[model samples]
Structure formats: structure tokens, C-alpha cells
Target chain A: MDRGKISKWLKYPEKMGHKYSLWAIYFATGCGIMEIPPVLTSRWDAERFGVLPAATPRQANLFLITGYVSVKTLRPIVRTYELMREPKYTVGFGSCPINGGMYWDSYNTIKRVDKYIPIDGWIAGCMPRPESIFIAVTKLWMMIDKGAATGYIRYRENYRYYRENQERILGKLDWPPLYPEKMGEDNG
Target chain B: MDERELELFFGPQHMGMVGNFSITLKVRGDRVVEARANPGYLHRGFAKMMEYRVWIQNFPLVCRINVMDPDPYELIYAMGVEELAGIEVPERAKYIRTIVMELSRLASHLAWIWAYGNALGFDTIGQWSMGDRDYIIDLLEFLTGGRIYHIYIWPGGVRRDLPDGFEEKTLKILDTLEGHLPEYDDVFFNNRLFVTRARGVAKITKEEAIELGATGQVLRATGVKMDIRKLEPYAAYPYLDFEIPVREDGDSYSRMMLIREEMDQSISIIRQCFKKMPKGPVYHRVPNPFKWKVPKGETYVRMESARGELGLYMVSTGEDKPYRVHFRPPSLPHGILILEKLLKGASIADVGHIMMSLYIAAPEVDR
Candidate 1:
């Protein structure tokens, strides 16, 4: 009916091609394969935005750095970021990604997700409201349209400051204590 | 033909996951051959951190363990130390604690509703649930400055006295929420799709659940009728009367229903607490936050959290800091061992759903 409508119809088939980007996501960086449902669901779906996971360093344009990252997780996070193609964007879902919202000072939780990966958006809640998540996606979309999606470059340039000397933003988080049973190895 | 297994790790950042945890799945064709949970992402060395901060500082810190229902942590720790130090909580302080605790319960269960809906791929349910949950958080923020982590309940008593007309405002909010319950049921709790997806999934018998260390809804869902509040009434719970909802089937569906019904019970408790609350000083006169030293003693206090029985084992050395603070988090048995066992033959899609229903707090587990 209109030029924009014609363009939308033309892009629909091409957009469908992005669903396969999930496998590329797996091949690109294997963070948590189990958490792929929300990443692939009908709503909050990653494929519709053309910002899907890439299999290798060359195929990826955007990195959906969803969920929390810790020291144990920091290794894969760093490796995956390193493997992504240039001019990529990183989005941290929930407060776990930024300032370790719920898990602040645990030996394992990285105080700030921005320590390892360059975050384009930091959703405030512990597990962010999906509306905030959708807002983040829109922000990322705007960044893409503006051709300024490379948070990785800025991260690399300021790497030393964020990595070595950044003050832990939310210091000494106030939370309930979680203590594992002492490792006695005395099971008979 | 090949002995070498292809290892596929899921989560620690994946979308289908409940939180920051990984599942190493060995998949042969479409079925999972073996699965193991790797949880350490949100670990913040809670016990170690507790050892560093003073007793009062730990009140705000402990609430972070399980962000959903934080009132229990503050209440239990304060009560435990108060018992050890022999401090008498004022009558008004006790009633205020009960009001706050029940409000925390309402918010916690509401958040659980969002997670449950999201897990089953029902996004609208999640949206509605979260919007409704925000009302509870709003009410909480009105009482306490912070939304998710309300560092309100302190040793001796609450942090501040009830704001002018706080009870009236809270009751009004509860009235609004009561009207919205049937709509939530239509969309989530009794939704046919959710009912189908959750029914019979992870079915455990009562005896099996007891042996598995299942507490809270997991125990109640199996028709166990076990609740820590009833068994050990700490803080102001001894004064409040409430019913523990139980279900015959211990499946994921039954557990979801049990939690939903529990929210109603929590609301009722809040209403009762408000009706009977006496007006007086909100906080008892305790030593200041920074330089306070607790008597040397070990107190094991357990409270019913949104998940289950959360036991805080505080070992004090009569110093400004705790000698050792060990948390017997309810989520561990369910999130780790219980989840691994139940997920053995289930589809990979249902993993996050089951975990959400279990309501694992990554910080709680890691601490």
C-alpha cells in the first residue's frame, strides 16, 4: 500500500533468516545454552531485531550479554567478546550485569559486568522487568541505526581504567548470607 | 559407537536459565544423556563478607541473599542476636515486624508469579505479574526507602517507626490487590496452558520430598503441610495466626498453585497484622550500627522464605564482627541436588521453568 509497507514486506523473509542466528550464537560463544528460551521466545525474541548471535568472529554484529557474569563466567565472557566481529553492541540484562545488583561481593560475582564486557545498557532491577528489557532493545536498535554500535572499541580504549582501578560502584552489597556446607569429605 | 561425550554447557548467561548458573548437558540425539548444575556466578563470598562487617551492617547485607523475601533474614538475624544478648523486643516492635514480614511475603510471591509465567513462555503473564508486583514494591518502598532490599528490620526493632498514616496506605493497597487476584488467576495460576505445561512435571511423593530436604512450597505441594512459621514462631509470628496451604500432587503445577495460594495467605496475614498492630516505638534502643559488639554465641534461626526454610547459623566471637556466619539457604537443596535429579529425564526447555518455580537465589546459594 505504501513504500514503507512494501519495504516491511520485503524485509519479513530476510528477518526470518535470523532465527538460525541462535545456532551461530552457540557456535560463537557457549555461555549458557540452557538460557536460550527467552532469547528465542516470541516476545522479547532476539531474532526479530537483526541482532542475533554469530558463530565466529566474522559473522557476529551484536552480542546479547544476557544474565549475570562472575569470575568463573568472566573467562567465557572475555573469550566470547574477543571472538565477536568488530562494531558489535553488548547489552546487560538485569542488575547482575551491572554493579552485581543482588550478588554484590561474593568471591565469585564480578562486581561490575562492565569489568569484562562493554555494556551499552544497564537494566536496574535484580532480574529486570521485561519492559525495561524491551526498552534496552530499542536503545540498541537506535544505536545500530545510528551506526554507533561499537561499545567494544570504547571498552578496549578504556580497558585499563575499568579493569584495574575502577572503584566497585555498589560497595559492600547488603544481602542475605548463603553459606555452603563445609567441605569435609567425610561421607562414609 | 563413540565413548567421547559432546559437552554442551547451558546458562550462566543464557536466556532459558533462571539465574547465573550453568548446566553441563550431555545430549544424545534429542534426549539428554546426563546433566550437572554448575552454580557460582552470583557467589559473593557472603560468609566471608559477614566476617568483615559489624553485626548491624550485616542486616542490610543479609537481605541480599534472597532478594524476593528479605524481611525474614533481618528478622531472624536480629531475633537470634537479641536472644543471645537477651534484649527484650518491645510489644509494638514485635507487631511492626510481623506487618513488615507479611508485606515482604506478598512482594516475594508476586515476583515468583512473574518468573513462573516467564518460564512457561507466557510473556503476557510475566508482564501483568510484574506490573502487579510493582504495587507491592511501591507499598514496601513507602514503608522502607529501598524497594527490593528493605533494610528495615534491625536488631532491637525496626529501623524507623511507621510513617504517618502508613497502615492506612498499606491497607488501601492490599484492598486494590485483593480485587486483582481473580484476574491473575485467569491469566496465570489457572490458565489452561500453564496448567498443562506444569502438570505432572517433576512429581515427587511426600516421603521422597522429606528425604530430599524439600522445604516451603516444595514440601507443601507434596501434601506435607510443613511450614517453618508454624514449627518455630520467631519475631512476631507467634502472635499472628495463618494457614499453610498444601496440595496433594507434588508436581511443578501443584507447587505453582501452592505458591499462588500462599500469596493469598500472606495477604491475609498482612491484613491481620495491620488490624491488631499497636502503636508505639518502632525500634528498641540497641548499640549503634558501626561499633556494636554482640555476645559470643552460635544461633541457628530458620524462617520460611518464598523458597523454603532459610537457616542462618551465626557464630559470634563477642567481637564487632562474626566469627563465622553460615547460611543454610533453602534454595540449595532444591536448586542444586533436587533440580539435577528431577531434570534427568525432562526436556531442556523445562529446566528454567522448574528452577524459577524453585525460586533459587544465586547469592543465597553461593553464600
Candidate 2:
């Protein structure tokens, strides 16, 4: 509202920019996708938090994996996660993504998403309320501020371990590497 | 000729598309020669998963089958169980079930409106529809605990009676929504630009619609009057009266018009339920849910969801768990078969619009 605000932004535009403008990809993997309409629209208005839906993974910094992740969907989830650039953040919405919620024993769905891809934060509910989504986004800003959201770093350092776990379930992966190869190991 | 045709995957992660489903389009220039819908991106193996859970446990799980309209699944499951178990629902509970079910329909149609606008690049209408849809969600929140998945409509009867002054609050919300309808008509529904863009964009003939197994708004928009509510009345619909909105054009515009009018009808149906509602307990006492078992029998029950005819077939061998379960969701024809047929010979620009207009939700297709 004032020049002071503009001056503060001018000094640390990168930090403020990353904090203020978090664009989540409009990708939904589960039933929790229903909560997204109210959050993004005029109802709960998640845009007031400077959050909006990006059309693709390449353009987005914030990723929300809503609800349960089935074995079939996990491949695309990993691909979508890899598509995001550095300084990216991920928020696993609903209890399904955290520990599979009611679908814990489901033959197809993944019990916990963290085993494959690192999750920065989790909102636990069968379907979290629209207001709770905004609170999660606010908390995400705090994580970004403190630099505690190192999911990307973790993904890089432990790519081998994550890839092995993924390969065990999704045998004989067809796609090529997301990150460049190392010298010692086979590219496969 | 085949060499000229390029294949592209219109992915699920797209903003203009509905749910986690994709379509592989074979296009030459800008016109699609063939289309194949790729589902299973959102499949949680719903029918397969349901067999493992006991009857009561399956109630909450079935709502996830169609996120946009969860009640009809719950209704069908409840009805199927009621049929097999020979549970007679109370009169007043039927009325309450009717009201809540129609409210779910209204909420879903609002969602359809948002999807249509989003597919056609009308952001303002999408926002307006979603914002308006929240009023119904708020009412649902007051009545049921959950906003998205109510799980309120259960076997034997509903989960709870109407809340204190709920009828008055519903009337107020309906009136407020009714007042805003004219403004909506001016901005998006009746706007010349929107009409011209959507009219005759994706046409489905009446004969083809029926042959292709199309129902709900898809068939209704094509001048066919086939509704499960009128044909086989369930819950309190037999006591209540409502008209099915139909348009003969069988195009995207007609479907949009029909959905808009249906919202008004849903409001009316809810009103009628309230007016004719007799005061009584909402739910009938039944055996313990965990221990509840049906006599060895097979039963099929159907209901009219926001999408269309939703049916559930349950088989029991005198056991608490279902021996077999199958869902006849409208999305199968509406999403995969009808979508592939409709996308042929259409411009790439109209692909998303046509799909959304058909109300092809991915979960229903995959499930």
C-alpha cells in the first residue's frame, strides 16, 4: 500500500518474489481435486495468497499432489515432479498422500508418497477444507523463508535410492533419465 | 495420408481439461482424424477396492468414484444394500434423502458450468459458477460434516435430520442464487460471443446418442426424454414432481442451456421436498453396521446423478462383504466411447470444449 512496501520488495525481490508468487500446477491425481475449485475461485480465493494455477510443470514452482497416488499414477507424478525447475516446492494435500487415508489397504494406491518423492508438507484429512489449503500455502511461505524446504536437494542427493524404490514397483521403466548421468554406474 | 497425420497426447495435466485423463489425437493439419481417450490416470480401482471393505465401510469409499457428484454413488450403493437386505426406509427419511440428493445435483451442475467455461476460455464465468456453487457447499457443510464428500445418504435412510432452521437457510440461499441468475445470463450464458462459440460445436444426434449408450444431459440435449427418476422413481422422487429439461439441438450450446435450466429445477425440487416434508426421524434403526449382512441375493439399483444414470449391482452370499460389485457410471459412454466418436473430424481447438460439454469426468471412466 505504500512506498516502504515497494522498497522492501526492491531490496530482496528474489526472496519476496519466491515467497509471494507461488504458481501450482493444475494437476490433480485423486478425489481431493474437488477442494481445488473453491480454493482457486472466488469462494475461498487462494489467489489472495499470491497462489495461482500454472498450466504446466515447467512454469510452476509449487506442486500439489491431491489425494491418493495409485501405482499407475506414480510414474506421471514422478515425471511431473522432475519437470519442475529448481527452487520448486511440493505440498501433498489430504491424508491420502500422507499415509493413504481410508485407502491404506488399497491394492493399487501408494501408502505414503514420501518413499518415492520428497514431500515438503502434508495436510491430513479425508478431504481438507478450502480454508486449510490457504493455511498450508502460508506455512509453505514460512518454509521457503527459512530455507527448510529442501525437497529438491533431497531429491538430487538421494536420486539413486528413490529411483531404485520406484523401479521395484514400476519395473522396467521406459523413459530416460530426469537428471544427467554419473560416471561410475550404468545409465539404466 | 497416414504419414501426414501426427499423433499427440492431450494430457490430463492440462488446465482446460477435466480430471487426470488424456486423449491421443491423430491430427492432419488442425483437424483430428481419430481420437482415443486414455483413462486409468485417476483410477483407484474403485469396484475392486469396494469388495474388500465391508458394506458400511464401502459407503464413504464410493463417493470418491465421482468427485464432482458423489451422492448418486452413495445413493445407488445404499439402495442396492437396502434392496438385498430388505430394509424399508421411513417416509420422512426418503424426503430428506431426496432434498440432499438434488442439492448434490445442483452443486455438480455448477461444477459443469465452470468446466464448460474453463474449456472455452471464459475465466469470469468459471469463477462466478464456482463462487455460486460454494453457497450449496456451505449449506451442505451445515447439514453434513464434509464439504466435498458428504456421505450423508446412507443405507436404510439418511445420516441425520435437517439441522435447526436449515429449511429457512436453504430458501435464503436459493433466493440469493436466483437473484444472481439474471446477471449470469447477461455475462456468460446469454452473451453473443459464448453462444456463437459453443452452438453447434459438437453435435450428437438422438439415434447415435442412444446407440452409443448416452444418457443424462447428453441424451436429454438431443431431444430424448430418458430419465431414471421419471422411469424408475427411487427415494422420495415418486412423491415429488419435477420436469426434465430437454433441448433438441444436441449441440454444446443446448447441453449448456439444459444444465442451466436443470439447476432451477433442482432448486424447485428441493423446495417441494421441504414443503411436503413430514416431520419424523431421518434414519431407520438397523442392525450394527459392522455386523450387518444381507441374505444371499443379487440386486441392482440405479439413480440419476448430475452426470446421468448411475447404477450399482451388488451380490451377497449371506456375508457382510459383497461377493461381487459393479458400477454402471455414465462416464463410460460419455467419456470414452462417445468422446472418441465425437472428436473425429473436429478442429483441435474444439476438442477440450466437446469433452467438457459431454461431462466426461476421468474417475468415472477409469472406475
Candidate 3:
């Protein structure tokens, strides 16, 4: 622990704790996952920033949607995102997740991942460098400090719209609605 | 009397999985009775997508088809376009292309080692290999702008010549990797636990390998002695002197050993490329990307990628875009066909081990 931010540690210990230990789901969404091995291992060493790969979504709080989300993968993404506990933050890792990057007109890939699921931040590049991952993590820390990284909250508030967006691309999802009470209005 | 079977879905989210690809296994007790490969999670319709993009624009897109090893896709695409348009690559570019492809093969094999290690529950090898892979990635970044997707190999030749001191840096990295091989063997390959676990698991006979379209290490491990570089030479492979390492066991251990041996071959190939590279223009400029129209013809070009034989069949019809583009990635057979066959009687514990030994890159299968 750094002595420089003693007051910060005292005032909001919980937020500070969440800020550091961001366990990301080891989910390889697309080509962007190519950079992940280097980031996690001895080269870039993301563990220095307290970011480590979680085996499952339940164990992870930080979800880095690594690359383009094809329609086939969207269902699993939604399921994984829903499985994570509250205060989970999602960072769209490449240009593809923002607006499809090079695969803009791909027939099977969804253009905006945010339309299906809320993203707290975006790392812009065809495939962002491993160093960019560190930058994104630091930026996420700032967002968390300010209480602005609330994509999970936003997701709950607007679950209907996100579901609608997902249903538009993928036909009726196999699983039940995550928030059943919120689904009382339009049961479709 | 009747027997009950458990339906186990093992991927798309499992830690033991290769990537987005999944397999549905019907298991009785600890042994798998039947296995069905489920792909398309990473599909962006690459072959169809390539048809819509202009000839020059597809260079960047092709490499994304295989995330583990991308340079071969670039080389095959370039070869396809060059053959269609009758463009001759400069002699220097040929050597440079060879060096880049072999370097990519080295990097990909290292990545495979990491995956294989991880699959076998040996996290130590995974850490070491992944860290070692970064050095090669650094070399690639120095030569090309991008680390993962190096859109360097174009129709006529490479995008640019080697940067100053690139040769020296490459040789130094090669020396470092060569020195570390023995340590890798001691920790992972030759370890008693690894040998016992991998020895007879998912063994493939020579006939099964050939019949099922297994290529690269899968085919080579079966004592068949088939290599695209040796059989159908490409780039500067015709000039380089390297042996194709073959093992008779056709087991998981044999495949792993073949990968280790191939890394040595790749290093040697790169060294030969640097020694024999002629000094000249690295690229012969193609016509403007927006206005260029290739002649009406279809050409099929294949090369030995790190995984296996990667082939691309491209057709141009006097338009700015290609009429048809099809890629035969090695993972298709290894991941879907061979995997399903091999998993029939394998224990649940060896699912990941067998998959890694076959070296299935999920993106290649889905793409």
C-alpha cells in the first residue's frame, strides 16, 4: 500500500479494494485475445496492476470483451455477463466492439457490443497493444474512484432495451430473463 | 438392461477449451462415448467477407482467420493474388518472406507449447513459453508495425524492407530461444508427469491421419513424412536446407516432440534466410488499390503454416474485388474431424490435452 493515498484508503476502502483486484474472465472473444497471453504472463505482466484471469465469470469482476462479437457468441456473452456479481465493469477491448472495426459489414457479427451489453469504457484499436490494456485498467481505476464505472448498474436499469437489442440479432434466447421482476411489463 | 449417458457441453466458456469452439460429449462414466464439435462462435464469414472487399483490402482481413499463426495466411493470400495478377516478387522479398513465415512458425509453436502446458495443468510451462513468445513478438513489431496482425506480405512483395539492425536483433532473439529450449524440455517435455500423461493419449495411426486430412504436426507425427514446404516449396523454402522431423508413435507425446523439433527447424530456416538474403528492392509496387483490377483467373496456392498446410483459392473477374476467396485452414480437419474421432474413447481428463496436442486454433475452424 502506498502512503501517499492514506486518506483515500480510509475514506473508501471498499472502492479502493475493488479498484485494485480486477479479476477478468479468461474469455477469448475474438482476434484481440492474441495479446492476452503476453499481458497475463511475464512480458507485460498485468498482475502488477492486480488484474488476473479468472477461470469463470463468477470469479471475475472485470470483463474485457476482447474483439468482434459474432451473433453466435453474443448469447454466451450475455449469459457470462449476467453471471458476474454486482460492481462488475466491462471494457470493450478493440475497435470491433465499438462499431465493428474492420468487420463493419459482416453478416454475422454485431456492430455495437454496447447495444447488447453496456461497456464502461472502450480501448480503441484494431487490436489494442498489451500496454493499452494497462492504460485501460488505470483509466478504469479512475472511473471506479469517481463512481462513474457503473455499467453493471446501467445494465440493470436498462435491461429491457438491451434484451430487445439482443433479441433483434439473435432469436429468442434459451435462458430466462435475468431480472424476472423487470420483465413483468412486456412478457415477450 | 439399459445404460444411461450424460451429455456434457465442454466449451465456449470452459477453461480447458482452446477458444470459442465447443464440443458436446456423450459420456458413460469417465470415458467419452461420442463427441460432436460445435464451431461458428468466432465466425465473421471470412471467405464471404473477402469477396466483398477489394483485392488489396483483403490482405489485413486474411490474417485474422488464424489468431495463433497469421503470417501464413498473409503469405498464401499474397501468393494467390500474385499468381492471379502475374506479379513477380523480388528475390530479396522472397527471402524476407521466408524469414517472416519461419519466425511466425516459431512464435506459433511457442504459443502451442504454452497452450499444451496449460492444458496439461503445468502452468509453469505456460508462463515460460508465453513470456518467451513475447521476444519473437517484439521482433515482429520491429519488422512490421503491428505485433499480432502483420499485414506486411502483399501481392508483389513485402510491405517494407527489414529495418536497420533487424538482422542482428533477430539473430540475438533466436540465440536466446535456442538456449532456453533445453530448460523447456527439462521442465515440461521430459518431465515424468507430462510423459505419463501424454504418452499413449489420443494416438492416431498413419492411415487415420492421412484419411482424415490431418496435416502439419498431426500428419507428420504419424511417420508419414509429408511437409508442404518439402513437397510443394514456397517462398525461399526451396533454397533453405532443413529436415522434416517425423515421429512414429503418432501419440500426443510424439506431436509435442515434433513441435519442439520444428521450432529448431524454424530457427535454422530464419538464420539461413538472413545469411542468404540478397540485397535489393524488397517490394515491387502494385497498381493503385482503388483502381487496380486483376485479370480473370483462378489460382490455388498453398504453403506450410505453423499449424499445417494453409491454402487459398482466389478468383478475380476484372473487378476491383475478388470474385471468390476460399481458405483451407489446417484447423478445420484437426479441430472438427480428427478431434471428434480421437475423443471417442478418451477420458474426460484428456480432452484438453488431446485438443492441445492436435494444436487446434478455434478461429481457424470458425472462420
Candidate 4:
């Protein structure tokens, strides 16, 4: 709606569309989910920022992993990531996913979430406030505008490394690889 | 024609499911023939981790056990450690703890209303209740410096005393919440759609509820007058006079109504705490955290959490760390045993509805 950004919007129409409407799939992994309702509801009203909760992963572009990812949950996290359509964004919402937060010492939780799945941004706090989500969203817009937020592209390029890291913890994921086993190859 | 049965997996991902929990259902047509709860997705192994941390260090770790209602875990842990160390909480601290716990209950019940409303296809009610719940979260943030994880209550006493004008702010928020109750009734509780959806669904008898270890609103809704606050009084509960609201019908509607009425009771209890609190220090300083050693003893402490009877059984072996720490979260029974039983013969659509009515926090079941 800003008159000044009209020229910029006209120049990069597809980028502007993706930047504005971010349908989020909030994967409630831990304690950080407590802040999500407030952010989505009337208090913070994430709709104003064009961030809304999508019903399913296939429908969503923004994947907000909203807490600590335990060993058991990591498989589902990986699966959900694979299921989402390309040009997707993933934001680790709390301190847990960044570096395991308080569950760093615990045996079950994975330390660094980036080892398993690519993260576009991280809003770091024990439990980040609802306002922090908005800040993350705006920052994501900037990243998308600059062509910097290419986590989906990164995942595709380095699928083997990410898959190997996931297998190290999860022990042989039941599903096959999203991309080919080898890069730049026709498997047929 | 032969009968056919199909296996269905309900969430850790589905929209209707609660948190990172799933249930395997055997369905014949729309009706569930058998249900099995699959928890442990949220388990951080708190019981195992507590063995490594010192007495005071465990305080912060315990609250994350139940995310929706964290205060009761704090209260129970503090009570367990206080019992083991034989530390007496000040009279003022007792009153403050009571007020904080009740406010937590109100916040949790409001959240339940939000979830319940949403599960039952009442998005308007969900938005209204969640918006209102933020005011209570703000008050908690002001008191404890954290919204979700308060980490306020400890072994000796609370982390801090009530700030100036705190009581007035709390009362004003309570007034606002109380005023909205009637509107909630109009849109949510008294609405014909809610009644039609909730009534006679997941109905349980008084004997069935008692037999299956169903506590909190589940038992109360079944006409059993059992409240840990009343039955085994803790903190300032003995001094305060509040009724345990009960209902004859053990259906989902009755359970929902019990939660609504208990919010009223929580408000009254908080008001009474403000009136009766005496002037004194909030905390009695304990020994140094690093060198502090609790005498060899084991104690079981239980309290009325927002969900149900949250009990902690702690064993100290004259060491800085606990020998073993066990939390008897009410959700363990409600989510697994009671939930599985209720799901049987239930329509596939009402699975989330019944689960929410039972107030099953998945973390509590696994933690």
C-alpha cells in the first residue's frame, strides 16, 4: 500500500507476491508454542503481516518450527519439510532449534536443527514473545527481497548432507529421498 | 457383504490433534472400534535430567514439563523440596503462591476454552477467549518476568514479592475477564451448536471416572466432589473458602461447564487471597545452591494443577542432586487411559473434541 514501494513492487512482482502472503505451518515442537496463539490471534494479529496458519504443509510456504525438536519429532520434521512445495521458508522459532536451548544437556533432543533441515532465519529466545515473530517475518521479507532466503534451494543443493545428518540421529528414515541420490543426474 | 475395518493415523501433524501427539485408530465406517494413544513426541526426559542438576537448578527445569500450565509444576516441585528440607514458607508467601496458582488456573481454563471452541468449530469464541487470555499473560509477565515459564516459585519460597499496585492491576484484569464471562456464555457455552456438538458425547459414569484415575474436572463433572485443594489443602488453600463446582452429567458438555464454573471459583479465590495476605518477606533464603545438601529422604507432594492432580515424588540421598524425581502428571491417565477408552465407539469427528474436553497436555503424558 505504500506509494514509494510501488515501483519496486512492479519491478519484482513475483518476489513481492511471495514476500507478502506467507501461509505458515506452525509445527508445535515444544514450549515455544505457548506464544503462537497470541501471535496468530487478535493480540498480535499476524494476518496484518500476511502470515497466516495454513491447514497443511502442502499449502504452506513458511514453516515455523515452534520449539525444541526431540529425536522422535525430528523424523516428522524432516518428512514435513520434504512434503512442502519448493521456494518454501523455514524459521526456527526458539532457542531450542538454534542450539537446543535448555534441552542442550538432555539426551533425547538434537543440538543444532540446521544439521537436519535448512533454516532461513531464527528468532532466538527461551520462548520468544509474540512481537518477535513479527520482527522475524519482516526480516524474512528483506531476506526474500535480496534473494538471500533460499533455504529450499540450499536443501536441494545439499540434500545428501542433510539426509545423512538426519539418518545419524533418526537411523534410516523410512521414506525415500526427496531429490535424487546424486546431484545433476537422471535416475531412469 | 463382508464387514471392513481400516487403520487410521491421527496426528502429530493433523490440524484437529493437540500438540505433537498422535493416536492410532481402528475404524469401521465413521465409528472408532479401537484407539491407542501414541505419546513421547514431546518427552525431554525431565525425570532423568533432574538427577544431574542441583536442588535449585531443578526448579527452572521442572516447569517445562507442562507447557500450558507451568505454575503447578513449580508449586509441586517447591512443595516437594520444602518438605524434604523442612523449610517453612512465610504466611505472606503462602497467600502469594495461592493467588498466582489461581491466576494460572484461570489463564489455563481460558486457553482450554479457546482450544475447545476451535475444536468444536467455534472460531469466533476461540478468538475472543485467546485475546482475553493475553491480559492475564501480561500480568504474569509483570510478576514473574516470563510469560510461559514463570520459574517464580522455589523450594524456600517465591522468587520475588508482589510489585507495588500489582494487586490493583490483577483485580482490574479479573474484572475485565469476569465481565466477558456472560458474553462467552452467550456465544459459546449457551449456544445451541455447542450444546448439540458437546452434549452426551464422551459420556462417562461416576464409577467409571473414579475407577480410571480420572481427576480434576473429569471427576468433578461426574458429580464426584474431589479437589486436592479441598481434600488435602496446601499453601493458603486451608484459609480460603471456595466451593468445588460439580455437575451430575459426565458428558463433554458437563466437563466444559465445570471448567467455566471453576474459572469463577479461581477468580473468587484470587480475590480472597488479595484480601487476606499479611505483610512479610516472600522468601526464606535457603542454603547455597552449589554446596547445599538435602538430607536423605523421600517425599510425595501433590497439588491441584489446571489439568488435575499434579503430584511429584522426589527422593534425596543426602546429595546435592536428587536420587530420583518422578512427576505424576494427570494427563498420563487422561490422555492415554481415559482418552483411549472414550475414543472407542466415538465418531471419528469427535476425537479432538473429546481429547480437548479431557484437557490432555501431550507433554505431561510423556514427561
Which residue pairs does candidate 3 place in steric collision? none
What DockQ would candidate 3 receive versus the native complex? 0.79
- What lDDT tens digits, residue by residue, belong to model 1 across residues A15-36? 3232223233442121122233
Candidate 1 regions with alpha-carbon error over 4 angstroms: A1-69, A79-86, A90-106, A109-115, A119-150, A154-188, B1-6
**Docking category of candidate 1:** incorrect
Colliding pairs, model 2: none
Ranking by lDDT: 3, 4, 2, 1
User: Which regions of candidate 3 are displaced past 4 Å?
Assistant: A4-7, A185-188, B1-3
Q: Which rank order by TM-score, best down to worst?
A: 4, 3, 2, 1
Interface RMSD of each: 7.2, 1.3, 1.0, 1.1
Q: Ten-residue segment with the worst summed lDDT in candidate 3 chain A? A: A179-188
On the 0 to 100 scale, the lDDT of residue A62 in model 3 is 93
Query: Interface RMSD, candidate 1?
Result: 7.2
**How high is the CA lDDT of each candidate model?**
0.69, 0.87, 0.90, 0.90
Q: DockQ values for all predictions? A: 0.17, 0.72, 0.79, 0.71
- Cα deviation of B312, candidate 2, in Å: 0.8
Give the fraction of native contacts in model 3. 0.76
Q: Name the lDDT value of residue B7 in candidate 4.
A: 98
Residue B289, candidate 2: alpha-carbon lDDT: 85
Which residue pairs of candidate 4 clash? none
